[model samples]
Target chain A: MSNKSLIVTLLATTLLSGPAFAEDVTLTIESWRNDDLTLWQDKIIPAFEASHPGIKVKFTPSAPAEYNAVLNSKLDAGSAGDLITCRPFDASLALYDAGHLADVSGLENMSNFSDVAKSAWQTDDGSATFCVPMASVIHGFIYNKEAFEEVGVEVPQTETEFFAALDKFKEDGSYIPLAMGTNDQWEAATMGYNNIGPNYWKGEEGRLALIKGEQKLTDDQWVAPYRTLAKWSDYLGDGYEAQTYPDSQNLFTLGRAAIYPAGSWEITGFNAQADFEMGAFKPPVQNEGDTCYISDHTDIAIGLNAKSENADAAKTFLNWVGSEEFATIYANALPGFFSLSSFDVAMEDPLAQEFVSWRGECESTIRSTYQILSRGTPNLENETWGASVAAIKGTKSAEDLGKELQDGLASWYEPQQ
Target chain B: MKSPRIKSHVIVFLAPAVLVYTAIMIFPLFNTLRLALYTEADQVRMFVGLENFRTLFGDPRWSESFWNALANNFWFFVIHMLVQNPIGIALAAILSHPRLRFAAFYRSAIFVPTILSFVIVGFAWKLILSPIWGIAPDLLSAVGLKSLFAPWLGKEEYALTTLALISVWQFVGIPMMLIYAALLSIPEEVLEAGEVDGITGMAAFWKIKLPLILPSIGIISILTFVGNFNAFDLIYTAQGALAGPDFSTDILGTFMYRTFFGFQLQLGDPHMGSAIATAMFGIILVGVCIYLFGIQTRLKRYQF
Candidate 1:
């Protein structure tokens, strides 16, 4: 062939061959896990990429505080990533209602999730699955074991013993009984209200009843918990209101406080910096020998964007997320959080094993205030936090908080019957 | 004869500005006003007229927070007027003195905080004033004023005032620069004439310099009023959307944000958020109108 003809033939051949070569598909996954970027980059993405050739995963991480706003804006612009982080209840519901989340009901791994895990990421009608449940977080008190031993106080199992333990720490005068950071407001609710609120509400049934208007927040059952929170506030030490969430965590890690109530998500962080041995316990029950309810709610779940051009590839990524391999990687990367799947994954961290031990021993697992509050009105979460602060400061009585809660609920809650 | 035609250049120059302004500012303002008259229920939006306003002002749950925020907003503006403006004027007067050393350096140093983002300022102040951290307390103790130190940002009684002070500290440079420029524009001959008439230093500033800068002061006052009323970022960064310690630091901006966007457990109500915005707009409009008609007319501008 002539030189010109050969060059042209090579160009045409290459051009024609391009159609036969499979293009690499990039699935964008957005999460508000800026702190754990290394985990996703080094472990999760690499594992997924290795198993599935010709498919590349791009992870976009945002700060936790601004994640929801950023995600909403992306969804509104119809440019959200293929796989998105899904917050449980109202946040997930809103996206599902807007048809932004793909229905992955028929995925084979969907059957692996427990009913509780499935329900958390399910639509209101329970007819379709919108996300693959990833992990569940437990909330309770993380105590400084050395501080407890120094004060000669053992972990309490009931309300009376808990108070006695606080008194002992108070008498010691060196350590704060409860390292509460009320300045952030939500920390108080996350550490105290969610951990202890279920005791008075009587777990899931009572919360559901409250939602249905069968029970009022002002009812006698709630007064005890409110009063208990108020009493617990006294043990938080001086200038507790000025302490921030990170401040409280620091206090606990430094052994300045005996106990710090927080979620399982904090375990990985605490383990890295804590000088003292750390231990966690379920909040004590009100009545002696009564079973305690632990705050075990879905923490993070991955949803496929319904409008994504690469839905099939996204589904494949999500299916692998539900597999045993992904669960092992995820659970190990963040040690304390338990995987929602029924796969036999061994938890390596002793602290994580301590928390996981409660799963079988506790009377029941309950949702936090984030999940139980009515979705129709302005968020009751803030109101509850405000009430807790007010109760702590003696600005509002328990009865006053109860009435405030009822008024807040009355804004959007209607009687079901 | 044909009617006079406007020139193409006029249309071309005006079109871009007008189009940009309408798209960004005017359109959104009207749309928010329209949204205020509607309500959403179970995914359906319906016209509810002034019912949202009634709910905002009448329902005890909503009204309490609304009134609290409005009152707090007013106090925030008052603090800036009473504290920031006076300090700014004083600083400007001192810096305007002809023989003052390093005047440019001082001016730039004072203006530094104004350029910092609200998030940075909020968190920085939060850390500095934190009782647990002891930065402020330690400083006070070093000066033998430990007894005077308090958790100013955490207390309900002091949180709003502390935040207002922080904002004032950041923004006082704006008024200082404007007043300084006004002071600089005053004729040296006029001041020399004043000295011939036995006026000098403090007396000269009070009689001549202050009067000449009255127009600038008036402008600064209106700007501070508008800025304070619309303040949200600092409070949100420092206290969160709840604006807590019992919502003592809550203001119209935070209230509107929480209502419009919703927080944990609460679904957003755009209509109610719009109503709050409309309320804020009305307040700002009234303040601006009062300044334009009542205050500005009385403050005579002296063309030096």
Candidate 2:
């Protein structure tokens, strides 16, 4: 046989063998959704894998409390999964800044996200998108509808009315006016200060001004919110300091408290455990007729590891996550969290619906304390939270709390300058 | 050495353990110290000699939390020393008595909590002390001391002390067991000699037994010092990363963790975290040194 003819025969043989040689790519997705493992195992993964042939997704779950640290170690070791779930702001930004996150900006479904959601996963310069926005959580007071009706109190729209409602509950003396669990210091900041502080700060502009050093936390506007928080502390009832996050949730669910301020994440737990009818309301504004602000923050977003060997497969999965199809699946599976995508899903839960209704109705949605304080500033939340605890305990005045916040902010802001 | 050289098998047998120890313990220890000298800014890590340490000590924001945690840690140690050691010593004394009944059962029961996970112990105590649950309150009320139940774990003034006590309750068995073993090794002849010399019971223990067990007690004290200073899991499990009720229960371990990992709103600064860790290492080193030189040297171990 001629050499050319022999070579042609070998080439033809290799080409024919290619179909059998193709390997299924396995993409590992790391997440802190241990509680919702069933959702991923039963629904999300199967749906993704079904559509994308020759690709298998391996879900790696860790406890939420240890997820970031675990992810950090993995990333440092250059052994992180192909896909990673990151907390929005500092957590995602840190990875993005370190060039550990793959810039999936060219993903076709990026346009499906709103500007707010898009900005969350993007760099400060808006030059790179590190992750696909999955869900944004709403923070508000989860109240007992039965207790409100029994006391003939309308859902408060204003701070004055809110205080009056608390008085009504206090007068009834059968239930706690507000369930506050400051024992876990973050809870006070999360449920109390952050939920209420934004109403006084106006919105994103006010928060940005503070972040940019254009406004001091000790300013009258900022101080007013803390004062309001201090006043609200009065309605927490005796032994409120001793109350834990779970205890507060238990109190609200058991009809011991009229109102429980928390994030929408607790909806599923509340619904399953609560014996009485539960309703949610946006925290009241300073004035009777003023527009109230809702505390909205990104819950979880999917980021691709830049160092992943299966980058193409990871991007494919992330692009799918940004699609309307994935949004539907996500929304159906975790109905409590509001999807950040333009894709609309009907929320059947009344409490969740109430929060969704506030998306357009409320004056504005602002970042939660965790997001605001976590950016570039170290221990600001703890310091501010400590001050808030002191204010609630009547050990420190609201003015002192404001000053302390100002001092803490200056410590962070001055060093940067 | 010239007469007989070490065998190849000795080196072969020793290499695995030495390699394992160096990889797990010594390498990481030195690496953590090395990380302390570098600071990351805008995702770029730069070598900044002593800058992180200076910031930790001089910066009000870092220093304040550092000092508060340090102070609280000291108090935590003091509580264990004052309440835990004494109680453990007394329990060991009682249990080690020749005439004691159900000694085995009591020893096992007392040591049970020590074997349990810190997470379980912390959460268990948290629930037991919860005011809303009425477990602690009802118990207090039963004794007509309900007013005295002031939510000790929730109060800034009391949170650290309450947690310290809880830690003590869980770990008292450790010192008890160690001291008990030491007491059991007391030869009986020496104790009999004490009895004959008019040193009976309390006199025998205080004059004869305790002095002989001083070396063991010293070792236990140093162990307690190290354990208490390095405590994190209990506080983190119970009060959370914030170590809250306004960080009153914040200890060095929790502080280092929060600084290292960055909790809530704070970005994790590895350099700063490492500096804090290095500081902790120094503190531990100093403590170990003091025990070895200042305390351990004076504690004469008997030949018994």
Candidate 3:
């Protein structure tokens, strides 16, 4: 056969295969997780397509940084996909207010989620929900087990012991004491401040009080975390000032750093890269007998596009997402992202299991600067990022950082004023 | 007016360029300036004449960020002027020597960075300077100067200066090429006149070559001003949108972008962003006007 005829025959076969048994509905999902493209195509779509033979699903993602802008343009042009992956809090809430996202309240299995899980994507008064909660990441310390053993240190349960362990590792000089860096800014705020903060502030109590204007940032509970972070700088090692997020991750995984102040999302990546046995411990309590608290921050969710043509099929997929089966597959696939559904997912990764196990022992609350506190000018979340970095670098005193944050918050936030 | 047939022919010939420019450039510029005059209240865009500007200048929250960015931008331009252009002129002078060898090779090597993408240059420099994976410390240690190596990009005091130097390294080639062309264009007759006057070598270049290239220097300075004001990609790639270690490297372009499109948790406020953009346009306009009317008119563009 001639080469041209062979090409024509291949094209004809491809064309003929389509519409042979056309699916009734094809739903396209828009997400910022371009990393999960294969996970969606190979694991998620296939699982959904199996049970629902008449429906097909497609997963399309943009670069994480560009997703919001790309989605906004697509939505404005009425060209967006059927399903939209939601960011936690105000970003997604703005989309819902603009009528871009359909309310997914009373969705199938929505009852499985707690109010805290749903709060991130809900209305201010908690009367309406826009997105089905997907996952929450826990904050803690992921440590190198070999380094701990080699340095003759046990997992630190109190702030005093935590520092002692760090000193031991620092003294040995075989490894850097801590792997986290302040260059990226978010790690200082998220993994360092929020992780250890809940214990000081007593979790939801401090967070709620701050929202109600009952507690200012200058309050000892709020300011104390900054004081703790100042000491973190000492163990961050030489030339750590310029270290980025990926560089910190490499330092920890390469067994060059003893402890990494981390979010649960680091589990899968750390497991894949590290040859050393890894273990996680909850954020150290101030005292040995203190009640512990964890920042189990709700990070992501899924929502239906208000303009989706096939709402029924889209809902079917969304409903499936809120199911135990989907939750198990997702949670196990991405170890750190614990499903928000209350169906009791058993995380297969040991480090992930260690992180999730904290929920039973510690009081859980989301990051303090999230929710309504971050909605105004001098956004508390962004402000916290700077304040935390300053705190860790010892550039600003804890009391001064607190005052600066409080002043910024009071300028616009009504309750704070 | 011309004859109807001639005018129609003229219109037909000019239509595409006119329409394309209006659609892309003129319209957007006007629209952005118009947007600066409005504020979004309850999702309604209402005309509030000069209110946004007042807020930008008088409101400490906005003004602090604005002034910081503006100051950083000036420093960035100064670095380019003080370091990049002078070095460029020196290089062009050296390379322009009558007996210089491998001149073309040297020229191409320096110009290579100018053609490279900003993202690649930013990331490459980031890795090269990185303490952990980088060989910078090793290289310094090889010379017994390891203690001198600090994380230049991470320190707030040094970040903007470090970034400015990186930008200079990338763009010094442009000024070099421009000044080199200007030097090459000076007629051989002028050099003969200089030789006759006993003004050969350094004296010949300083007295003869330097004066002829003054206009080129003026043009390069203005181009540097405009380019520096509009720079966003390098800082955005290296320092990120926040332009940290506490926004030390934040320039007008990054400031406008952050306000216009938002960062992590901050939502976009187009009106405020437009106001920043309009301010930038005004600054550039004043700079260009100063170059054109005040400076350019005074520059002695001598005839051959």
RMSD of 3: 2.9
**Cα lDDT tens digits for candidate 1, B1-304:** 9999979999999999999999999999999999999997666789989999999999877899999999999899999999999999999999998899999999999999999999999999999998887689899999999998877877899999999999999999999999999888999999999999999988998898888889999999999999998999999999888887788899999999988877765656779999999999999999999999999998876654
List where candidate 1 sits over 4 angstroms from the true fold: A1-22, B1-5
The lDDT, on a scale of 0 to 1, for candidate 3 is 0.92
Docking quality (DockQ) for each candidate: 0.62, 0.61, 0.72
Residue pairs in collision within model 2: A374-B265
Instruction: List, in order, the clash count of every candidate structure.
Output: 1, 1, 0
Candidate 3 residue A193 Cα shift, in angstroms, is: 0.6
The sequence of per-residue lDDT tens digits that candidate 1 reaches over residues A300-327 is 8999998899888989999999999999
TM-score of each: 0.94, 0.93, 0.96
TM-score for chain A, prediction 2: 0.90
- Ranked by DockQ, top first: 3, 1, 2
lDDT of 2 by residue, B150-240 (tens): 8888888899999999999999999999999999998979988877889996888889988988988898899999998888999999888
Cα error of candidate 1 at position B135, Å = 1.5
* TM-score of chain B alone in model 3: 0.96
Model 1 chain B lDDT-worst window of ten: B261-270
Clashing residue pairs for model 1: A379-B266
